[model samples]
Target: MTTTPALLPPDIRVFERGWLSSNNVLCLGEQATVIDTGHVKHASETAHRVGAALRGQPLADIAHTHLHSDHCGGTAALQAAHPDARVWVPEPSLPHVQAWDEDRLTFGDTAQRCARFNAQHALVPGQSVRLGARDWQIHAAPGHDALAVLLFEPEHGLLISGDALWEHGVGVIFPQIDGSDDFDTFNDTLALIERLDPRVVIPGHGTPFGRADGGIEAAMARSRARIEQFKAQPAQHALYAAKVLIKYQMLDVEAMPHAEFQRWLDGTRTLHQLHQLHRPDLDWPAWLALVLAPLFGKGVLRRDETLVLDGA
Candidate 1:
């Protein structure tokens, strides 16, 4: 069933966004806070929307479920807009963020962009934080991003599931793609969500969905099936990831010249690693072509005589 804003607590507002950015969760209280700002390209819009939603409530804090570029890219803009707002990031990410290590943070590796921002606090798993009038329990949610966390409010059975859980599927297993044994960790995260038994889930993307009456079960089943396939044939997962990255880049701009697209594909270190690990025989250009053919055939992307465009 569809979940509407009215279904959420009166003080909470969710701004569902497109693929380029993650959904923004605004928790209003004596200390107004916003969780998971969108990508940098949409930073201004994100700031404007958040400002309007606040209705003049001084933004006391900004929080992140994880520091993926899409999830935290607008942070710098938000901080500028609300100078008094304190930023809170995951405890494990605190060091990298403080040092501004884009490599360790995965921004450079993924060829994604996030303007530098600072954090004044960290969200530790198993701890609790108050947002609006409720206390949220923080739980470690790795696999999608090794440092990710999910927030749960027992009083309302509401879960703020970042990329760990979505309506159709989970986020790409970056740890696995990056040469870590994290498929099991991803499953463990799904199991943890099952034990929580939330009544509703505010996922990082798409509309929030009810977990009661088979919604959560169905989503889990689909996610498990997808992960199992990846486990059985990891090369397939690598190919899938390549397409996702390409589409994500396309979403950031109206169009790109073929040469620029090739350069981007060349520079994305993660893609190169995936290529080396999964299809070394084909070479980079051939591998890229193989990955792009399906995206073009499905109309997920289109190419003119000189430029590539986002098809949908």
Candidate 2:
């Protein structure tokens, strides 16, 4: 299939943003469109980066796989810069976005920040959108986020798997935390990705990779292991979720005082709910004080008397 060269199509380039934002896929041609706009905190940087990539080209449209804070946080800022740029989001998330409901959109619930933005159009499933000269097929992908979607370009065998199928493993099964059994659906999504047999995958968080079979197989195995582990010990998953959120915040802030970190964790309603369901035995202050231990011991984070640094 000569997958390598074709998979790295010049029209589709990935701007590899770090944690807290998904990679922005730049599809340039007659009308420029960007998939995912990074995080709101880095909106200005994202705009400048994309602008430079375009070389004076005006960004014309934006499409998101999901409404996760990181993926669409820069939408409002980007729209303000290019007021004519059309924004599209998953159809299911249209209402929450239109209402600017941070809670419903999960920013507020998770204690994360996302600039409010309006999506003028919906990224409807079973339809194709023009990203440059090619038509990218949109398919409903519900695993990490119930409403996430995957964009596939058949001719090129390129897939924008979003967080549904990352290079390493799928994103957190957030539906579980929200009291939904989504492991089966997640498995189905992975199977679908495997069936499509993409030559290259531009995932939501990591660098793009080629030859999906090995990665997909490895990721599927890892996912099955994790799912089985979670099924047996749900609390472990809860704790993992808590740590992920903390690490995400630390990635954005780089560092924070212990008091502020504690407060942030305390205020994160989603984490709190996970804790309540799985670790309710401990009181707030006690759990708060001990919760960072595992992450610290694993070298995922570093903590001093008053400060928590990013993997310090």
Candidate 3:
């Protein structure tokens, strides 16, 4: 958790994490709470980071913005670190979470990893949750993931927007994979953010921004263009999703030998799905090389004969 202290409330700090994990928001007050603990691989680091940031203040609560692997991967570690702290997750997925149903929870089918964790409470939309000594209105944001929520504080004009609205654009419209056609909902969620008119935005992935209105506008433009492109060619979106998932895995490992990397990349069911959806004619290696060309071309990754390194 890299400390980002300026342009935010003294009580609220954004722990900027690498791309593989979501940024954690640490809220300090009479009852201290940390929102969104990054990817599972970094669970121990995240727990230690929270401990160092707490400065002996007992953590009283842990909450999630969503249940994506990157968003809630450190839940178990944090719970272990502060056993007395209550855990709250998005309400829609609580049943699946309680049962640890990997498919419904999106770990199995996606080949993503999330350490099992328990949720004692629910973060229901339309409710005001008290965290970091401020009342946050929990608004249902159903674009990135159906159960995702956005938190806003009217008094401070601060918004804790999850993946639904990033500074650059929204995340993949994952519901489309199930043929749910959630692009409209994603657009609606963007409209909701625009309406919030937040002065500052602490997004799920990047650093907090002060002039969020302009960010919102820029994000909306990108969202609309991407959605139109995705709508026109759904298979392209699937290929993009495959790349993102692959990149996320690469981030988790940092670097991997070619043989192990190929095995891991081939292991993802989502990537296989994309292969079947878009390029059944090409073999896995050929298909992967084609899809990964963009990443390599952009210098975000480096591929050699023996190993692959995440350059970005």
Off by over 4 Å in 3: 1-6, 255-260, 280-286, 296-299, 302-309
My TM-score estimates for the predictions, one after another, are: 0.95, 0.91, 0.90
- For residues 83-193, write the lDDT of model 1, one tens digit per residue: 989998999899999999999999999888899999989899989988666789999999898889999999889899999989886678899887766688999999999
Q: Compared to the true structure, candidate 2 yields what TM-score? A: 0.91
Best-matching candidate per TM-score:
1
Worst 10 residues of 3 by lDDT: 211-220
lDDT score at residue 149, model 1, on the 0-100 scale = 96
**In candidate 2, residue 15 scores what lDDT?**
83
lDDT of each: 0.88, 0.82, 0.84
Model 1 per-residue lDDT at 203:
91
Report the lDDT tens digits of candidate 3 across residue range 1-312. Answer: 465556677889888886788999988998898999999998998999899989988899899988889999998999998999988888988899999999888788677889999988899899988887888899998877888899998888888988887777558777776656557888788788889888788889987776634765676688788888877887888788888888887787789998888778777777787787668899988998889999989987898888899877
In candidate 1, residue 116 scores what lDDT? Answer: 98
Question: What's the lDDT of the predicted structure labeled candidate 3?
Answer: 0.84
Candidate 1 runs further than 4 Å off: 1-6
> Which residue pairs of candidate 3 clash?
none
